[model samples]
Target: MTCPLLKEDLIFNLTQGLGYEERSLALYEEFLTMLEGKELSAEEIHDKEIIERIASDERRHITIAKRLIVIAEEYYHTT
Candidate 1:
């Protein structure tokens, strides 16, 4: 059976360079773990507020990966 999470286009784009789907999957899995453990600080949740350094660091990698998929689909026709 295929893993539903692995089927996402974002996961596909991130893993393309690595050539190992498991690497991307592992990154997102860790991201999910971080998100599950807490509510963001009031300051961190606002669009105009500067995100805390620690919180930004925690989310940056996955956000980059997700952006890659959007870029691919929107500009490169990867999908």
Candidate 2:
């Protein structure tokens, strides 16, 4: 039998990671907005590119987290 405690812990960790990713995504989006319509130096432009990449990663993480949560919940109930 699957351990309910393990499942609960997994869900908790997943939830935490999901929240962190969401917050990170929001901050990155806000940073991008702040950069919009502004003249950026070469270094600033590079930083923006990096931020964009990180933001994309965060979005991917969020999607994965959501799917995992659903799967975990299903397993939790079925066991």
Candidate 3:
């Protein structure tokens, strides 16, 4: 699934590298909390399903954030 944060520049900055692991995990936890509290938009609902699937795979925020960090690192490297 495509990350909702992929288009968010600030989130990109926050999860840019392995050095920010703690912060990244915190951010994702906050994001999940926010998501859980509201009636999701159509897109968000779709994303939520995807997130649930991934989460059920035993992938926690730290693992997801680490992957995002790797992607962000590659992005920074290219541009």
Candidate 4:
């Protein structure tokens, strides 16, 4: 038998993490849009690169969270 409380907690946490990552990804995309067509200094360019990398990571995190949620749901339902 699956523990209802643990399953609920896992789903909730995964949902929250997904929301956070999505919001962060949106903000990063907006910032990148704002940077478009602007001449950047070397440091600014480096910072932008870092931001892009982080945004990529956020996207990965979102995917992982979604997958986990699905797996958790399926596991709980089956068990």
Candidate 5:
């Protein structure tokens, strides 16, 4: 049987990573908004694109983390 404590630890780590990704999403979203119409240097423009990519990646990470947490909870209960 799977260890209950191990499941808890996995869930906790997933939750923590989820939180960080959420925060990243929020920050990037805000940064993207702040980049509106105003002119930007070439580097800043490049950064905006990078931020957009990171934000999208973080969103996916959050989704995966949430799914993993649910799976972990189910296993935790069954074990």
Candidate 6:
């Protein structure tokens, strides 16, 4: 079952989540850009791999957040 949240609460959480996801995506992109044109050190390679994995997770979080927001909207409209 879905936890009940006030309209403002739902919006607040969704806005915060999107902000986090946006920042996370930018940070990951920046990391990738920094390493893109240059040769990667062994350490850099490891960092990049880890970052890539985290970036994927961040993207998933973004999608989930978006879906939740939509659900919240529907819930509010229906009720």
- Summarize candidate 2's per-residue lDDT along 1-79 as a digit string, tens digits: 6654788799999999999999999999999999999999999999999999999999999999999999999998897
Model 2 TM-score, 2 decimals? 0.88
- Better candidate number, 3 or 5, judged by TM-score: 5
lDDT of each: 0.51, 0.94, 0.61, 0.94, 0.89, 0.88
Clashes of 2: 0
Q: Write model 1 residue lDDT over 1-79, tens digit each, in one string.
A: 3334434555565657434434554654566566555776765455223323434553565566566666655654432
Model 3: CA > 4 A from native: 1-19, 49-79
Q: Indicate the TM-score of model 1.
A: 0.30
**Which has the higher lDDT value, candidate number 5 or candidate number 6?**
5
Candidate 2's C-alpha lDDT?
Answer: 0.94
RMSD of each: 12.1, 1.7, 11.6, 1.8, 1.8, 1.7
Tens-digit lDDT string for candidate 3 (12-42)? 5655643455554455556677788798789
Q: Could you say which candidate leads in TM-score?
A: 4
Runs of candidate 6 with Cα error greater than 4 angstroms are: 1-4
Give one digit per residue, the lDDT tens place, for model 6 in 8-77: 8888889898999989899998988788978888998998999999999999999988898898888888
Query: Which pairs clash in model 3?
Result: none
Q: List the residue pairs that clash in candidate 2.
A: none
Ranking by lDDT: 2, 4, 5, 6, 3, 1
lDDT of 4 by residue, 3-74 (tens): 656888989999998999999999999999999999999999999999999999999999999999999999
TM-score, one value per model: 0.30, 0.88, 0.36, 0.91, 0.83, 0.88
Instruction: lDDT for model 1, please.
Output: 0.51
Candidate 5 Cα lDDT to native? 0.89
Question: Tens digits of per-residue lDDT for model 5 on 7-74?
Answer: 76788898999999999899999989999988999999999999899999999999999998998898
